[model samples]
Each structure stands twice: as C-alpha cells, then as structure tokens.
Target: MSKLEIDFCGVKFRNPTVLASGVLGVTASSLKNVVKNGAGGVTTKSIWLKEHAGHKSPVMFGTDHYFMNAVGLSDAGIEKAEKETFPEYSKGGRPAPIIANIVAGKIADFGKLAERVSKLDPDIIEVNISCPNVEDELGKPFACSVVDAAAVTKLVRSKTKKPVIVKLSPNVSNIGEIAKACAGAGADGFCAINTVGPGMAIDINLRKSILSNRVGGLSGPAIKPVAVRCVYDIYKATGLPIIGTGGILTGEDAIEMMMAGARLVGMGTMVYYREVEGFGKVVSEMEEWCRKNGVKNVEEIVACIS
Candidate 1:
C-alpha cells in the first residue's frame, strides 16, 4: 500500500526485502518458502563451478547478538541448480525474482559459471568474491583487492547478459576503491558488506575454537554498523545500486541500510532467527512506519541521512 517497489539498474523488486544467499536458499523448496512468505527477491546460496562439500560440522557458532559461520560456499553447483532447483522455483506461483549467487577461485571459473547460470534467466548474478571463510594467497579474500574484484566482475560481465552484482568484502583497507573498480568493470550493482570478520570464539575450558574452521565470518546485529559504513562509502564512490546486507534483524535495521544508500536490503541471520514469515512481518512494519511518516516510496529515503 505504500508503493514499496524499488527499481535498481533496470531490475525491479516488489519491495526491498531479499533473502540473502546461504540462509534460506540452499534448496529450491527452502527458497520457495521465503518467496511465499513475502521476500521481494531471493539470492540462491553461492554456487561454484564444481560442487563443494563445504566445511565440516560445527560450521556455525552462535553469540548472544550474532552468528559466525564458515559454511565455505557449499553449494550444489550451477549445473545442478539450473537443472533441478531453478525449475521448481520458477514454476512456483509465488516465486520472487531470483539472483544466482556465484563464486569461484579463478577468473575463468567465474566467467564460465556466470555464463552458465545466466541461461537460467535469473534477474541478476551476484559474483561472490567476498567469502571470508576461504583461504586465498592474497591473505584476505579475493574481494578484498580492487584488482581481483575487478577481474572476476569483468570476466563474468563479459560472459553474461544478466546484470552482475559484485558482493564486496569488508575485510579490506579501501572498500571504496574496490567498489569503484567493480563498477568500472561493468558490474551492474553491489552487495555490501559480506560478513564483518573472520572472527573467532573459543571455549576456554575445552581450549578449542567454537567453529570447526577456528575462524568464521560474523553476521547479524553486531556487524550492522560496519555494513552501513561500507554501503555508505561505496555509495559515495560509485553511485551504484547496492544490496545492503550483514546484520539486518528488523525493519528498522533494513531502513537504516536503505537510508545509508542501499537500494535493496538483504536479510540473512534475521531469517535464520525468524523463519519464513519473518520477511512479511518486517515488511508490514516498514509499511506502517512509512505510512505514519507520510513517506511516498521507499526510494525517497535512500541516503537521506544528513
């Protein structure tokens, strides 16, 4: 009722609430449930050129206010998703626009994966160079460097006609520079900031780290401020449409990201906490707040902070 539609880089969503990759998107049924519950869009779990078994068990450790995960981009691969998952979701009456989240260790892998998934006709393809749990020679993830980020993004863009959104890593010295490079490399948009840290939690009595990987990426409310800063910086640098993610747990949190310059806000840990219907609840609350404040459309509030 509040005209919640948001258009970004020629792609439009019924609203700004999207299910972030790796939360409820591991399978077709799970993704369909999120859409049925009112997700404006859904980003499938980050897929790779080849299937990965992912990290071991105890991959997730919970903190009082957030979560740390080392899921390691475990996916069924692009070919399987195109053959199995996408067909089911596409046939669902309530299916939301889908964005295929893809990751790879090499530039050629990124291009091949993007080209393959682009045929599935997803609304967008998010190149995931930002996964923090993996090991890379650059010391940080590939998304941390402007050169690597641009290389992956440009390669993918060259192979696909679908809009490409480069998901940026927060574990970087100059996020704005990387963002600018991605935009210049023909990226249609950006999704910031993937997990705030390769943080760790330890069991002092057991003398062991809580997560199997020992270091995991932090998500949820604890990382919200960091995500806001990344979105703000990138917004200032490139003016690209951003899918803000990280620590969104409520409608107010989503609004904060949008006001900080995100065209769409992704909800991950919140959905893990609230389940499928959580998306509708958040959207309803946002609508109420907008109506009472005499807001016309959500986009009018982007970067409204002063």
Candidate 2:
C-alpha cells in the first residue's frame, strides 16, 4: 500500500491532498487536469439549487501573507452538475474521486441540493453551510449555531446515502460543539476551518475597500495556525476524520495538519501560490518527509501531537 493512501469514510484516496472547493470553478475538464497534476481528489465549488450570481467582479485580491475573496458562493446550480459537469467528468472513467459540494441559502434548500447532487453520484457529498461571504443575504453561516448545523446535517443526511461531510467554519467560538451536533445528526466526516473571517482590506491609495463586496474570508499561509487548532479541537471532540484546510502552501504544512488529526489536507489557495502542479509537489514533499523520519505510513502522524 502507498504510504499516502487513505480510506476516508469508506472511500479510498490515492493520497491525502485534495483540491479544496472554490479555487477553480467547477468544470469537468479543469478538475480532471488537477487530478492529472497530482491531486488525489477534487471538490466541486459550492453548488446552489439555482444559478447564483455572486458578487460583482473585484471580488478577490491577495498578498504574500494572505488571500481574501468575497465570491459569494456563485454556482451554475444542480442542473449543470447533472447535465454537464458529472457527465463530462465520468466520460474518461474519472481520474480521481470527486467530492460534490452542495450549498443553499435555506435549510430546506440544503436538503434539495443534497438530493439532486447525490443522484449525480459523486464519490462524496460535502455540505457547505459555512461560506462566510454571503452573510448579508443568508444572515450568518449555519455552522455558527449548533442547532442549525445539526438541522442541516440531519436534512442532508436523510436526503442522500452517500457519505456526508460537512464543511465547517473557523469563525465560530466553539467549533467542536458545533461538530458534535453534526455528528449526532449523522455527519460522516468534516472539512474543518473554512476561510477565516469576513475580513476586509483597504487600498491605502484607492482609499476604499479592495473587494467589491467589502468583506471576505481570509485564506493562504496566514491561516494555517487557525486551521491546525480547529482540526485538533474537532479531532479531540469527535475523533471523526477531517479534511484540514486553510493557508496550506507546502508539504510541511500538510504534514503538520495530519499531526493535528486531519486525514486529508484540503488545499485551494496553494493553487495561487504554487500553481496546479503544487499537488504533486506537496505529495512528493510529504513522501520525502516520511522517509527522512523513518515513518512507514503517512497515517501514523495523524493526531500524533496529542
């Protein structure tokens, strides 16, 4: 068996590096390209029930320390997934596992999106109740309230037989409590520490907020500490598998996340820092680290810190 190979929620992954949702838009060809570049799996961008016109352009900007965006979860909806994305992805026998990420503005809509996306039969279903950009319209993310998070989890769980992994937010006070609620409601696993903050940046010269949306979630190398802490907390709270994400830019960062109890490392902003080939690069780096440490399996490091 490969040192990096892992079974997450009954699904086998060639490696633990997965393309986080929202980096590259959901296109079958683009996703396939990422896999070819060496990602063990790919997650679709947040899929709404109907086409969503996200915030107008100027939605993103970045620096060496951080990346921020207020893209607002725009998507072409489930119709596109059923008719175009999934069909095209399956055309070539699917190079890697696909995690279908479904989102909605309402709890009921969550169930509807789950049901429809599940029928398309992606390898796993990620329920995105934590997008921070749309708080103005949606009135705060569902991940903030344990009761509401559980509600969404229960509804989505009932709608699909596929593994249901809830994407969590880092903006909360006690992420572990929220995670426990979801676990009780039947969540199969979790993707912890979504972008941190609905933060903003101002162009000193322009004298105004950078993004058109004014505020956005923070990503890139800056948030790795927060990601590690959240992953550690969630693991201690539930011992469920986690996809640790946020500010992961190197293979060492991936190994650090695994030591915090993440079964897989989710990366999005790394694409911005290292390009698509970063996946293979990080995987190779991980292997080298393992060999140097005399570790036989990558899984051996999971939660080793505690």
Candidate 3:
C-alpha cells in the first residue's frame, strides 16, 4: 500500500483527502474530475428520494477566512443519480470510490433513500442528518437529539448493507454523547462536524442579508478548531473512524485533523480556495511534511494526539 493509503471502515482510499458533500458533487463528471485531480474519494451532493429544489441564486458567498451557504440541500433525486451519475461514474471504471450522501426531511424518507441508493451500490453511504440550512422546511436537524440521531442511524443502517457513516453537526452541547448514541444504534462510522453555525451576513450596501435564506452554515478556515474537537470527541467516545470535515485548507490542516482522530479529511471550501488541483497540492504537501518529520506511514498519525 502507498504511504497515503487508508482503509476507512473496510473501504480503501488512495489518500485521505475526500471531496466533501455539496461542493462540486452534483454530477459524475464533477466527481470524476475531483478524482482525476487527486482526491482519494468523492461524495455526491445530498441525494433525496425525489427532486428537491434548493434555495434561489445568491445562495452562497465567501470571504478570505470563511464561506457561508444556504443551498438548502438541493438535489435532483436518486432516480437521476442511478440513471446518470452512478452509471456514468462506473463507465469510467471509477478511478476512486464514491460515497453517496443522502438527506431527507423525515425518518422514513431517510430509510427509503438509503434503500434505493444502496442498490446503486456506491462504495459508501453517508447519512446527512445534520445539515443546518434546512431548518425552515424540516424543523431541527436529527443530529441535535441523541434519540433522533440514533433513530435515523438505526433506520439507515437497516436499509443498507454498505458502510453507513452519519454526518454530524457542531451545534450540539455534547457531540460525544450524540456520537455514542449513533454508535449504539449501529453506525459503522461517522463524518464529524459538518458546517458550523446557521449564521447570517449582511450586504452593507444592499442593507439586506446576503444569502436569499438570510442565514447559512459557516465553513472554511474559521471552523477547523471545532471540527478537530468534534472528531477527537467522537473517536474517544466510540473508537470509530471519522471523516473529519470543515475548514481544512492545507496539508498541515489535514495532518492536524488526523492527529485529532480522523481517518480521513473532507474538504469543501478548499475547492473554492485552491480549485480541483488543490487536492494534488495538498497531497504533495502532506508527503513533504511526512518526509521531513520522519513519519513513514501517514496512518501512523491517526489519533496520535494525546
């Protein structure tokens, strides 16, 4: 195996850098482009059981330090994914594994999406129960409650034979407790600390909110500290591997995340900063760091923090 290779819940990744859900994840060509540019794996945008329209344009904005978005989990549904995305991704022989990220407004819908997407057979299925932008339509996120989180986990787990990783939120009081609850309900693994804060930003000139939805989740360099903490807590609580996400923009940031107990690091806004080629750039930087630090296997750094 290459030094950068990792086995996350039985799925092998060429490297630990994966395309975070909702970036350029809408189509097969975009996801494959991410792999071609050196991402270890790709996750599709949140797929619903049926078509779901997202927020209007002006859904996102970014600054040097952070990005705020309220895309509202837009997706064309699983049928389109099965008919176009999965088949097209497979047509190219799948340079890297695909993780289908599914979201729903209710528990039963989560199960249905899970069952349907399972048939398409993406290498992994990520249960997105923690999105912060859909609260107006769906009430609070499932990740906010231990019982609800576990319920979603149990239902999704029953629906799919594939490894199920529950995406988590950072807005909770004790993220560890929630992680433990999901683990008890049969979650194979987790992707910790999705975006943070359903915060708002104003357009000073327009004297109005920037996002059409008024507020959105905060990501980019600002939330890395929270993501690291959440990953550490989840790892300590369950000893389960996590895909550490939020605010990672460089190789050093990825290493810090692994040291905080992530088996893989997911990047979203980094794409905005460095483009697709940033994946390869991050990987090269990681190799250089390992070489200079006398680290042989990159996995050796996973949870090295104590």
Candidate 4:
C-alpha cells in the first residue's frame, strides 16, 4: 500500500486529505460520518465566541461550476465544542484527529475563543482570519488588512499552546505579506486560500442578488488557479506548513495544490457535490499516480513542479 502519512506542524495525519471547515463540519454526526467515509482529518465549521443564526434562506446559490455562499460564520459557539461536542469524538476512537476552525469579530475575542477551545484537545486550532462573507464598515473583509490578521493571530497564539494555523483570504491584494505577518506573530502554519472575492450574481428576473447578503465568497473549480497561486506565493514567502484548499474536485486537483507547496490538502466544495465516499476515490487515484511516478511518499510532491 502507498504510504500517505504526513506530519504537519507536529501532528501526524494518516494522509494529507482533510475536510475543510464549513457546512461539512457543522455537526458532530456529520463529522463522524465523513470520518467513517475516509477523511484523514476534519476541521469543524468556523465557530465564534457566541452562537450565530447565520443568514436567512438564499445564503447559497449554485452556478454551473461553482457556488457562492454568505454563511455569516453561523455556528454553535466555541463553548459547546469545548464542553460537549468534542467529548463525543474523544469517546469514540476518532477516525482522525480533529482541527477546530474558529472566528471572532474582535481581536481579543480570538484569544478568548482559542483559550476555551484549546481545552477541548483538538489536534489543531485554525484561526479563521479570512472569512470574506462577513462585512463591517471596514469597506473590505476583516482579514483584508495585514495588521488585523497579525494582531488577531498573535492574541490567539498567546492564549493557546496548541498549533495555530491562520486561514488567509484570497481577496487581499498582498497575501504573502499578510502570511509573513501571521507567521511573525506566532502562527505555526497557514491554510490558503479562503474563498475568492465577495462576488455577486444578480437574478435578472427578480432584479436582486442571488445570495441573501447580496454578495458571497466563491468556491469550487472556478477558483482553483487563484488558490494554487496563493498557496505557491505564501509557501515561497513563509515556508510554513500550508493546508491548501479551494476548487479541489479530483486527485489531480489535490496533487496540484500539494505541488504548489501545501503540506496538506483540504476538500470542501467537492464534498458538497460528491459526498463523503468521494474522498476515498481521490485517495485511491492519488496512490496510483504516486506509484506510476515512482514517488515513494506523498511529501516528495510538495512544490515538485517541473
């Protein structure tokens, strides 16, 4: 059998295939189901300090090749995960290590949330600094500024002993500088890139935008190239462990991100389309490709572009 094991930021994963945070990770039942179906790791949906009902209906709209959603960081809150949900996973022989993704409106809130969730004993805490769907008076997403990204990450790092991975927004003009700033502030790793622009699609008939928020972050194959470039750039800049996500639908797609310097690859939009079992199929195909190329280990392919 092909060895898919990879060590990312001191945590060992059976393979590099992790389920990205979002709808796929909202509930414990769904997380167990995906683990049973074969994800190496699963990141919980982006939780906040308090519960959020999220946006109303029409938050998601489908396109021919991708999707746009403005979920507004709706989650069950960090305390629930720390006190109740995580215990369930701990009881069962967890199919894989869990990474908790979290977000907060204020910088200090990041530290408080991180401190609470750290007690849950997850393998990693992913600081969600790049959620483009939520907007304030800032004119751009919260993570669009390097200072905000670094400050939040720094505060969270001070509160947790666990590995801290900052997820970056692709909407930013200078992703590399933002990434370096996070690393300097004590982030152990990074996940690039979050969904692309807060793009809009209007309903010609209704004369209104499709999503409830009027604009939403885009994901799926349409944004893969942009994601790939972001990962490659950050990899070149920070040399930190990267979890690459965005537009990965097939084994080849996953491999593309790995070659762009992602230590681990996250599958999101594809899961919504193919369901959980699709992860196994992608792993199998990746194994075959590895054997054909005489690659003994998956890590050898990181940044191996010719």
Q: What is the TM-score of each candidate against the true structure?
A: 0.96, 0.98, 0.98, 0.96
Candidate 3 positional error at 104, Å: 0.4
Regions of candidate 2 where Cα sits further than 4 Å from its true position: none
Model 2, global lDDT: 0.92
The sequence of per-residue lDDT tens digits that candidate 2 reaches over residues 1-306 is 238898899999999999999988569899999999999999999889999989987988789899999998888888999999999999959898999998998999999888888889889999999999999889989999999999999999999999999999999999999999999999999998888998999999999998888899999999999999999999998899999998888889999999999999999999988999999999999989998999888889999998
Query: What residue pairs clash in candidate 3, if any at all?
Result: none
| lDDT per residue as tens, model 3, 201-252 | 9989999999998879999999999999999999999999899998888999
| Candidate 3 weakest lDDT stretch, 10 residues | 1-10
Model 4's lDDT to the true fold? 0.86
| Stretch of 10 with least lDDT, candidate 2 | 1-10
RMSD in order of candidates: 1.5, 1.0, 1.0, 1.4
**Given candidate 4, what's the lDDT at residue 110?**
87
lDDT of 1 by residue, 1-306 (tens): 677898977887999999998887878899888978888999999998878877886898666699999987787777788888888888735367888998887778888888889888888999888888887322567797888889988899899988899999999988999999999999999999899778888989999998888888999888999999999999999988999998887888888999999999999888667767989988988888788888889888998872
Report lDDT per candidate.
0.86, 0.92, 0.93, 0.86
Candidate order (lDDT): 3, 2, 1, 4
Between the candidate structures 1 and 4, which one is better when assessed by lDDT?
1
Give one digit per residue, the lDDT tens place, for model 4 in 1-306.
667889999999888889999967777778888777778889999988898778876888666688898887788787788776788777756778899898887788888989889888889999987888877422465568888888988898999999999999998788999999999999999998888888999999999888888888999889999999999989988999999999998888888999999989998888767778978877887888888888899999998772
